[model samples]
Target: MHGRIKGEAAFRRYVARASDELRQANYTVSAVDLIVTPTRTVEEVILSTDGPKGRVDLPIAIVTDRGPGGLVEIRMYFSTWPITGEHAIRPPLLQHDPNVHEKGAVGDYQRALAAGDLAATLAAFEPQATVREPAGGEYTHTGTAELTELYTLFFSNGGGIPLEHCTVPDDGRACALEYNVTQWGRAAMPPEAGVAVYVRGASGKLIAARIYDDSNPPLHRPDPSFAGCVL
Candidate 1:
């Protein structure tokens, strides 16, 4: 879905237009990955799905923009996922997260997590909100500064890892996210599943986020430095 309108208005319009058709198809959209400019202006849109058209809610990496700028257009994809050869992955999508109780909140939260974008990720939380780890308190943060530090480490060292998240707990603020962490320094990491609860504040910004995951001995990286890391 592409719109030339300015800012969030354009995004709202895009969602409005897409919701009806998606609902009828029995496809629950937990989130959409959008590409906005450095100015924080949304310029690109991608929706992945499998339906009447060739639109792909393409499994993992749904939509990508090849911007030269003309009119805004939304491209849908079908059968997008891990490694597929000739066989096309199509509808009656059996595996999908139905935890989209709050569309906007869940969408922003999950998208930011997938993109590994720090600002967007933090923006989803409330300033005084706490982020708990399934591991322990030693790996938790509540304040903005602390959360920022925690995420800085996460984004730097914990990227390029494939993650799939969907709404859970019956369309509430909770999301069931599954991913793989390769290393925790010398320790071996395994495939993990976790629930991330995001709640909004008075201003509608994410007020708090609590994460619970299964990663063996937890993600206490020995060298949690952001030296050469890039977001």
Candidate 2:
């Protein structure tokens, strides 16, 4: 995969290569959901195609930010194992440490996560809020009962999953944060990059949180039945 391309010329070249690769793979992409704000837009996309084994569908998230002049920035989030057929650590995207000082509901959520307090984390979400896990749709946790069970397992490691927030794109309705996972609970690991979109409700609490990371939690166990690569 092309790591990081700078300049319009380089970006165009990378796009050309990607187009060729996808065409050769007979891949087709379709949008699943979209969230728009004054300055930001997040799209949940699904890429499908027939592969050597059979048909496969891969889910991905794309975040875009706009500015007064024109485009500001764009980033894509998805697990590479789906394409490479292997699980490996992702390299950090940001060269330097990030300055993370969030405000509003997102700030509260971040603080709660750092504290690793189950009650506080639950309070950050609406009564019937939903959290979609990174794997896919089947892993979504909904409502208090399900969320309670999810976070209970999450905080069992004794600390919060700390993320070094890199870029936060928000315009009141929702906020998308590009971050690097620095640590999970008491254990630390190599910085792994990921992105998540947090949607806010009328009460300023979270309505939904869609995560796009493959970071293994301390309690995570691999399932042999699941195949990492899709189409």
Q: What is every candidate's alpha-carbon RMSD to the true fold?
A: 15.8, 4.0
Candidate 2 ranges beyond 4 A from true positions: 32-41, 65-73, 84-86, 95-100, 220-231
TM-score of each: 0.43, 0.81
RMSD over all Cα atoms, model 2: 4.0
Count steric clashes of candidate 2: 1
Task: Rate residue 161 of model 1 by lDDT.
Answer: 28
lDDT of 1 by residue, 1-231 (tens): 132335567767877876876676556444422333322211112244455454433222122223456334332322112112122212211133444333566567656765667888878877787665432224456788997887766655454222434323312333322223333333444433333444556666666554433333323353432111101
Q: Rate the local accuracy (lDDT) of all candidates.
A: 0.43, 0.73
What is the alpha-carbon lDDT of model 1 when measured against the actual structure?
0.43
Give the candidate number with the greatest lDDT. Answer: 2
Candidate with maximal TM-score: 2
Model 1, poorest ten-residue lDDT window? 78-87
Candidate 2 per-residue lDDT, tens place, 1-231, comes to 577778899999999998887888899898866767777778888787666667666678887778888777777777644555544566766543466566687888888887787898899899999887665546677899998977877776668877778777676777777788867778786778777878899999999988876676654443553322110
